[model samples]
Target: MSAAQDPGTPPRPHAMLIAQITDPHIGLQPGPATGPLDPTGSLRRALAHVRALQPAVDVLLLTGDLADSGRPQDYAEIATLLADTLPTPADGGPRVLAVPGNHDRRAPARQALAAAMPVAPDAPGDCVCLHVEHGGLHLIGLDTVVPGAAHGALAAEQLAWLQRHLTACAGAPVLIFMHHPPLISGMAAMDACGLLQGRAELGRIVAAHGGVQAIAAGHLHRAIVGQLGGAPVVVAPSSSHQLTLDLRPDAPLALRFEPPMIGLYRWTAADGIACHFSYVEAFGPSHPI
Candidate 1:
């Protein structure tokens, strides 16, 4: 794809709002009242907040780890909760886009989710292509789910498909959402379980494509920002449980009692992309950010 822009047709300024929630781990039973692992309540409240947004979010892109165990019941709960939270097409309900995490089983995801959710456009119907034009900004969902493994990988077919779609845009503003980060975070443990195998190849594809205005991810269960191929890359905070950020492996398995929060991303062609690591009014802030 030519990296040139058309000065005359000047890229139209756009403002788009996306509500991103990641690593809900929604199926796990809340830990004892004394503990902070209230996946169910946190998720419930988080969804409520998303619903109550004044302008209404144009889309809800879940970055994965939807289930605690990839269980059928867990996905069922997610489907039902989402059914209540998501808007009706008549009322201009926010478009819902989701990809599986290490904890999610694609088969169960298929069974539990309603057929209405959009699939990936270029792939077969099994893989969803969720494309939404929110305030003129395009948000594209990519699947990096690899079952029975903690790691994630984008198959060659998917990578080629992504290149094609991104190139076709011809410099149009775009955002890509996926389950795993293509680059490593500082945490060594996470790096071991993050995107696997095709790092260099993926970077080449992304760097070569100029339309990726920004890229969003989930899986790390933290709100992280870094660069991948010169585009802004964001990782959403987990809703159900927290990943202990302690870079030291000697650190205890830390899951704090903080109330759930979701990451909100605002993207525009005019001012570029801005992010808010926002929490619902009822939640507390205990992390050392």
Candidate 2:
């Protein structure tokens, strides 16, 4: 049973609201296009949505693919927008945390966005693996980017470090964030290029720990819910454009101009965790039911 189910102990008074934004693909200023959609404008609208949330979120998780070409100027654009417009969390914690997508080059990403992320001494060359503790919750980030490849993989060293961290947090719920979705999405095109290796070992670690709340990821460019290592795997929608949903085994890869969106993960001692997807552009005003 969970902490909330323990009859002899008081329910833990901890809860967290996290906003996840992914695959911004913030290309250069001229025109950033993923199909017919303009990535830059889409991201601007997405951040606008985050600011409009009621009571604000506790932390913002940028799940990679930050830049289309991994260009310095593209990262600069993101930095400028985050520095100027991203809302400060209600609890006064760190503003945002991020990882690198396949599209992001390590040197540039580290030089540009590393300061905004947590740090771990054991992280391998330019790999962004780290952890953060907030409101009695543990958040772990793993770098799954494989140099010169579209698919992702976690090195054994990084996995070992992650195991150490998970072991240390045995009694507390730990949320793991990475760029690639570990499970196979029914969308064949995306799954073909998903996490390329080390998934089973990672799964075993999570299964053994038993304290992991959920695994949140991006790169599929759509919302997908599945199981990996007996834990919930959530694939968030891109903040820029979405992958055309075609479940056929031979479905051609395509992009759609669907309204970009963000993912929200809410966790409490009693409920454990729940996730929802919301559009970046408002369709209408909310009505009290």
Candidate 3:
């Protein structure tokens, strides 16, 4: 009999649940005139949605752009917001992890988020990199912030670090999270600021390791997917606003009021990994069909 029909067969292991909310761009004084009135409010709603999920999320990943201008006060405010909205790990809340974006100041971001989302002890002084193990899965967060530039890149040292980690986790599944996507998005302006350096080397590393299940990122303010070294790259939508879908060669950057969304990633040894984009807003109660 098939496993489904055989009552004696053990059930499959529970899947690991991960929720990603990115590009909130919080602390915009006079928030964007188009999207949600307050960026923090949007982030709060997204976090609440994650908290309310039936099977609580195992990890909450703040991909990047947590602050609009990467100010110290902004990060302070973000820390407060996180403390107020999410319960402590001791209280059964998911582990929080973050990486800096182009809009973030590495020093301030590291200082503020450290208390809540600590990085690996071996992480370099120049950037924030995280490594965590949960339910036999390896989660790695790579910092792609380039300080004064809008584009992103990984330093050689950081790349070497990543290679060492991937090698150590040779046969285990790994999920990578970062700020800027390595692949080019058709959006002209956005593509110009995409991961300009280390793209090829990163791809080679992932291909050689062959254990990376998926790579998740933010920075485009929209959901995008592409392939890098045979693994799917899932870019999460912004929690505050989305960029207009303009693929023209010279299309200017623009914002849209599309519903804010988050990325839900589920992984299991039996089914591999799957990503789903979920809207953060509450759309009335469901009625039986």
Question: Which candidate gets the maximum TM-score versus the true structure?
Answer: 3
Clashes of each: 6, 0, 0
Model 3, residue 26: distance off in Å is 1.1
**Model 1 lDDT vs. the true structure?**
0.72
lDDT of 1 by residue, 140-249 (tens): 67777776789888778777766776777666778888888887787777877888866667678778876677788888877788877878788877887667787775
Ranking by TM-score: 3, 2, 1
Check candidate 1 and list the clashing pairs.
Answer: 36-257, 119-128, 119-129, 120-128, 120-129, 121-129
Clashing pairs in 2: none
Worst 10 residues of 2 by lDDT: 1-10
TM-score of each: 0.84, 0.90, 0.92
Alpha-carbon local distance difference test for all models: 0.72, 0.80, 0.84
Worst 10 residues of 3 by lDDT: 1-10
By TM-score, the better pick of 1 and 2 is 2
Error of 1 at 168 (Å): 1.9
Per-residue lDDT tens digits of candidate 2, residues 169-253? 7758888999998998889888888898889999999999988888999999988998778889999999977899999999999
**Which residues of candidate 1, in runs, are more than 4 Å off?**
1-14, 30-34, 124-134, 249-253, 283-289
**lDDT, ranked from best to worst:** 3, 2, 1
